[model samples]
Target: MFARLIRPLGLCLILALPALVFRLSGIESDPLILLAVFGTGVVSASFVLAWAAEAAQVDISGGLAIAILAVIAVLPEYAVDLYFAFTAGSRPEYVAYAAANMTGSNRLLLGLGWSLVVLIALAVAKRRTGKSIRALTLDSGHRVELGFLAIASVIAFAIPVSAQIHVALGVGLLAFFGFYLWKVSRGDTEEPDLVGPAATIGALPRRQRRVLVVSLFIGSALVILACAEPFADALIETGAQLGIDEFLLVQWLAPLASEAPEFIIAILFALRGNGAAAIGMLISAKVNQWTLLVGSLPVAYLLGGGGVALHLDGRQVEEFLLTATQTLLGIAALLALRFPRWAAWTLLGLFAVQFVFPGQEARYVLSGVYAALALGAFVYHRRHLLPTLAAPFQDHPDEQAAKAAEQESRTAP
Candidate 1:
């Protein structure tokens, strides 16, 4: 039993070996080489982080477990981006990298992450049922996530409008996260259907399970923290040498590396035909990224350097606008609690095009398109709009959920 568990755990540690060595030995390498080594570390450690997060379900409120897991799973991203935010205090140029990292992760999670999960789930469902699953339907407990995301999306626009990430806004976002956690903590505890290594760890005795979870969180966080600065710098240096745009590289590649675990885990869930769990996990991640991860940037900046806010340049502003709109569209698409095939493909399509035409004008057009679609979706699913936004704050969420379920069944064809 010990050996069986050790195999998977050791595999992840081995994958992260190069980063650990580089950090400790202070090895110097080419920019691309550093990128490869450090990026591998981020990706590998993130897998460990995700497993630890999943195993943590055994220790937390069942309804809130996924959200907490979502938060912990993306800590690699927070480490890397926050490093940039902290550095920006002295090196002002790093401010863009910080914003870029945040926006990229949020966009990648929602646009690519959410869509691919639904697409894979649909394919698997079709294979089993001989009929296409039109959409992935979420459980009522997810209403809290949607409501929090809805509020975050609206507030996110202020970043671009004000052209900065100010302390006050950070406070507001943090407050939202705090309230979200508090609300979720009150939910009834249920046994989670964990799989793979998470299942292995979760099956351990309570005391051992917690100790291991804490150890993994600490170990992976140390690995991520050690690699974060070097990885961010290597990305920029490598981009310059290759004549690729550094901002774009920071915007995309860094996120791709940091969010790899989340994408892989969510994909696995979809492959198991559990699209709702997969999508719900990513949605919760979005809420975390938009609120907690992002909200911490200015704080990190202030602690690293004396700054009241982090200023956003033109490009950063555009990225924030695009990210915010994509988030709103995601919320609107999920308003009816069903992520339809068309919406999946539509989001995937839009996400792809953003890279194909990376320009200010193109960005504005894309943002407008997202807003237009989101507005239309809210109108089309008008009845669900109010309920979704109000779901998190109800005095009796379980009873409300029951009523909603009853109503849904009555309206079912």
Candidate 2:
């Protein structure tokens, strides 16, 4: 009994440590130490959040459960970026950090997170099923997510054109997210296939399971609320102290810290030969980040007394354009409900080029390249694109297959 309790207890301790330390020591004066403490807290809370989400599937429909999970999984990212956006209201210098963090997190999800999922899945598929995975095939039901993403991506271009995130934009995006949740909530429910610590907690008696899940959710939320401000502020201070470009640090480092847990969890799922679930979760997350996450920024700014819009400067404009273009390319690549290896590599390659040639000229040039490629893909796949966009409203074979897969996993010993 003691041995069985160890793993779950360890996870609880891991989830608790950072919050305990933060309460005891408060924010450290040393930026590096502060970063380490709060960052670790965020990562640990992320794990708890992930497990709680999976456990939730036992009680909710698969699509809605995953959607909720995606939102919760990204809470850390939201906390950090929203902090920057809200802070930017009064301190205009902080405006760039808000945009930097948002664009970087969005780009990283596709460039690093999506690509890594396919690569890892391919490797796992070969070993487990003796089948070569040329591409990661998404269920047709994902069309709902991809279609919504396409609409948002197109609207995102308007932000750069206007050089501001207006309240109207926020309203539109939030409306889409609300519709997305409603659509997904009506999807078929399946018994959840729990794994790892989630499985352990889920095996408990019903009342006990419910208690644990609620505890995990409340605990992780508190940890995030306690740590997000310190972590965000420490990152900026650390970059300043190290003489690192604050924009670059906010763009890459902050996201790397906040997004690490999700990346690791998704990769782990792929490695276990559950590539579909891994990619699906990431897809849902992308939608959440693009819609609710982006939409909430201007609202935060407004609440912080920054007026009705969040204004962007030149660099932020370019960043938004680049991020939006990349999103278009990603949707085109997955229009057929497939993520080909070549498409994955293309995303990673283009993302890397930005780091190599960091200038206004390069940003525009790369944006053009992405847009051209996306247009070509859309034109070539025009026939499938319409059907795909209509998929959420119709029954699909892929949805059935996904349901069957879930049933099998859930019943497995």
Candidate 3:
């Protein structure tokens, strides 16, 4: 009974956290907070259920999970955009905020999270099994995904600064989204196939699965958003207390907290030796943030008003540079293409260095230098790195199919 009740009760608390935060903040009971909470729960539930379904080898599309996650992830940004669109000067501030959040998040997934996973695996496996890390060979399917993410990141980074230019960028992002979906539909020959519908719904009756699908979808989203609000509020309040920037609070700390769910799921996937699924999910997240999130912001701004206009002060510029530098370091590590125990330690070192240092021009400059060194190391190791590390997980085709079959068989009975 407790097992059955925990998720629901946990979800309830998630829904209530924002209201609790507002109460603590001395703000009056606000309907927006409640609504946001509800939306967050619904979205989070959807993401969770879809993930469960996918893990069970159900026929339900994992794309739905990504889509729901993206939508809910952007809700706060959406709310802010609405506020700035009508009430504020220079409507473009909304777009700029969205860009920061999206780009920052995407880079975190790519440059940091991606490398961390492989590095951890290599280190732990080597320590335990006494084998060197092998190269992750990419078949056609993953090649496509890698290509897609790289292209999207480049495009998102290239969006011109002018408000007028942003409009075109939005349209381009939309087009890319459509093209991506179409490519997915065509199906990559090398990709593992999704679970069939019958198998997916077998665990629940048809009607029950339908209800579960809807409830889980909406409920998950609500929980995620609800949790996000309190999480954000707490971080902001704490950042103020600690004399840290709100941007750092949100970009790094809040995400570390709120995104725990996704990471937990990914870790589970990795532990199961479903490295492809783990990599796929991470890659999907980065691509979605880079293209879908960044792409849609300008469009959202334009619909709300003329367009978003944002100006970065020296402080913000320093922060962005720090983030970008860290990202470049991670990227350099990634381009080395081979996983090594040392790389993990190096990344941990870089991550640690940033936190220990005070917020000053000198500290940021040091960060930039570290990032540059990582990039240089990547270039130095290119021959050994690029060919070896690109795809760290590749089961033989027949073996992979056998694993899938075994997964289906266990789930079916």
Query: Which numbered prediction scores highest in TM-score against the true structure?
Result: 1
TM-score winner between candidates 2 and 3: 2
> How many clashes in each structure?
0, 0, 33
What would you estimate as the lDDT of candidate 2?
0.82
Report the lDDT of model 3 for residue 238: 59
Better of 1 and 2 by lDDT: 1
The true-versus-predicted C-alpha distance at residue 339 of model 1, in Å, is 0.9
Report the C-alpha displacement of residue 110, candidate 1, in angstroms: 0.6
Encode model 2's per-residue lDDT on 318-390: one tens digit a residue: 9999999999999999877778889988998998999999999999999999999999988865655665566
Candidate 3 shows a clash count of 33
Kindly list the per-residue Cα lDDT of model 3 for residues 1-413, writing each as its tens digit.
22443465366557555554554565643333443543354344434544444433333444444444444444443333233322223443333334345444544555466656665555455666688766432233443444455455445434432223265776787777766655554443222233322234435655665665555445544544444444444544555666876566455543443344455555655554554556556766665555665566656566655645333444445544555455445444444233344655665676666567747766567656856776686566444233332222332223343344355456644
Q: How many backbone clashes does candidate 2 have?
A: 0
lDDT of 1 by residue, 277-360 (tens): 889888888889888988899998998884899999998999999999888889989877889999999999999999899999
Better of 1 and 2 by TM-score: 1
Q: Supply the TM-score for candidate 1.
A: 0.94
Candidate 3: stretches off by over 4 Å: 1-57, 61-100, 127-130, 134-140, 159-165, 189-202, 223-243, 304-308, 318-343, 358-413
Candidate models: Cα lDDT each: 0.87, 0.82, 0.49
